[model samples]
Target: MINDGLTDSKFDQRDGIPDAQKMSRAPTVAIIDIGSNSIKLLVARSSPNNSGIEVLYTHTIETRISSGISQAHPRLSAQAIEAGTRTVTELLRLARAYQPDAVRIVATSAVRDARNGQEFTELIETQTHYRVDILDGPEEARLIARGLATDPELSTLNDYLQIDLGGGSLEVILLQKAQIQQAISLQLGAVRLSEQFLLDREAPIDQNTASAIQTHVRKTLETSIDGSLPSLPVVATGGAIVITRAILAAEDGLTIENRSACMTMQEISQLRQRIGGVPLHDRLAIPALPPARADILPTALLTIEAVLEVANADQLTHSFHNLRYGIAAELLEKR
Candidate 1:
């Protein structure tokens, strides 16, 4: 059992890796990530050895399809169902247009949490001849860990904790010697939590709301982690953390790599508070943050803060890589 409580833990910034000068070619791989908040399709060309996949094209559709699907008596709303179907159709069309050698589609937290998850999978297979693999949280965390290790930005870090916060789930993986030791996926996510708790904020981040979210996340992670909350270097991924990092960079006049840069707890707390106070319209105006994210960012911030607290990390590193690259890497290795 990995420790999930926030500790004043720290990790080294292991940047300055020599670029791959040989420019090895990448294979063409297509992947569709059915997340709770959105569906993304990525088509990339990669190297023969599965070392890299150069992104060729991408498509994203904000479905909110998994909204409210994690509650005690949850069901996929009609709107969510239609939106998912349409999103998959669009992605399949794009895949056909790209004519890639193989297309791999994986549904993350949202679909996995939905009672009608298989129904959605069947729909995809029937309509697009594509089988959607619903990855368990631990597998999701493992693949994300692999992708992070491959990133040249953090090339020197030997022991690291990687966190990927998605719409329907949050995946945490502990890595040592560039290998994964423990991985778990908690049932807390931006969109899922937002639909349930943060869709409408009745007040600011007082002790009450913060305590509530913290307790809920702590309990959920405790269950997922078993018993122990180990101390390790921390790395973070997913849209919320990425956006939070970007916003921090913009405000602090700091220039760090989008996903590989380190972030201070002060910064994380500040962002969480600032976003929680801002009106939805103003949040939408934030550059790089889409309108789709405005509603859920508050919950996202809370979730991040909770995870950071449980992990006992005073600072964290953020990354743009997630299910898309994970799927690509898995396919390349399998091939």
Candidate 2:
């Protein structure tokens, strides 16, 4: 659960305003997400009926704060911390322009797994005056599941497997009857795996390295999961997945907005093969692929492919509603 202290309380102190009046009004919230690869801002207002969120703005800045995360005693580098702080400050400033009633900043796998994560958060608080919530693995998974439930299309599904892949960790959630049956976070993130297995991210991944990554992912999933994953629909959300979708859309001469949300295992495999055969510089030439993510995108695709095999699912539905949306919904509901 999100901390009570993080909830909006500005409405509680209206001198002459009645509690009912305050409760009846919609509330706007800003959520700043500090991830291993990027920092994102989402400013949204709840509908009067509290049924949906209307997004006012969204932005992202890649800060790759999880560099060196594959080390035995992983620590955030000084350069990464500085870049992260600067980006967070800028995003916070932008988020405040909408006059949000409440603002929440949360950090995921990168900060939680780092040895000096406290140092990074302290700097942000001292400079920005907003405390960052460093979520543990299970709690992060839970919040992701909560966020996914907010999607109207996804809400109709009674059972499915959800995967949220990030730079530092991969969150896996199994939903049965629209309730979470299992939620776990693994160290199978793209950045983490690239650092661990790929000697040269700038170059194309050779067959041996690709095989090694697949093997590691399969073993990790097998060890973490008690038994075989049920054959349910799979849903994925993350920067990598979004980029993959965009690339596919571009290849088919269609805009990302017009592209289908569902992706098949064969499509993913083909994309991985094509993308993995090229070096980072060559990949940057591809449309809709972000340069910052070019190096690790191959590893990300590999990870996603392995996950699908483990789940015995051939296709995955991509959801734009993620952790921030989930947090935003919570804030609005409290109001």
Candidate 3:
């Protein structure tokens, strides 16, 4: 099992009171995550004793703001900027419904990597009247690790690996004995890889192209990952992994809620093969697979499988908590 770093004593000492008694004292907060592929909103409140978080609402909109992000002079297109701004406005409106004590809007790899990223953020700020905090890779990884700590199921884990694959970047965090040893971010995201390697996303990917993508991922990991990773359980989060788990669970005639969190390397490889062999349309027809992810899922799986190989991990446990959760947790702490 993976270690989450949070211990029972830590929780006990956080507030030293019953959660029920502290409920009214907790603060509600909203976090909007603007990513490469989508924009998401999360509204949550701290537990009465401030030892936990209670999710109030969540929503996602596919804006694909990172379109053409792999270009030589990467910039957000006019259409992408407009769509992203509209989505952010909509999500912000939804978040305001809860009258949160604080609201944080953050942008990730896509906005940070794009040459015209600041333009997009400026437009959002101009229209939405909210400051957008652009998170660097390390900060993003740190928040993701903090978010994973909120999961009670993983609270006992003291050492493990965490990987969060987004549309524009991949975040890898290594922790031993509850301390982070390394946090690395790479430009190995599914959308980036797809735009760079897969020229014909609408058609079935050829064997050569598939191999090429895998090779690129492996080579990137080989060079980017500094040293040999310890033999520890891997916990994966992010849209790609969540969608992969949903698709796999649906294939087995099980609901996402009832499916096992543990996914073997073989399962990931098999799914990649099955999805890659089909065209985008066929992948879209698969139950539980998001339409927005249909075109990039194959590449996402390739990257995920590569990560497992590099880590020498046989399986990974999926976590629902991620960056947004971490942001909310921090907001509550400040209150």
Clashing residue pairs, backbone N/CA/C < 3 A, model 2: none
Better of 1 and 2 by TM-score: 2
TM-score-sorted candidate list, best first: 2, 3, 1
Residues 1-335, model 2: lDDT tens digits:
22232655332333355768655656778888999999999989986566788889999998899999999889999998899999998987787566567888899989998999999998988887777889998988888888898888776898999999999999999999989999999999999999999988889989999999999999999999867899999999999999999999999999877999999999999999999999988999999999999999999999999999999999999998899998888887876
TM-scores of the candidates are 0.83, 0.93, 0.91
Which residue runs does candidate 3 get wrong by more than 4 Å?
Answer: 1-25
lDDT of 2: 0.88
Best by TM-score: 2
RMSD of 1: 10.2
Which candidate order results from sorting by lDDT in descending order? 2, 3, 1
Residue 59 lDDT, candidate 2, scale 0-100: 98
Residue 97 C-alpha lDDT in model 2: 63
- Comparing 2 and 3 by TM-score, which wins? 2
Could you say which candidate leads in lDDT? Answer: 2
Q: Mark the 10 consecutive residues where model 3 has the least summed lDDT.
A: 2-11
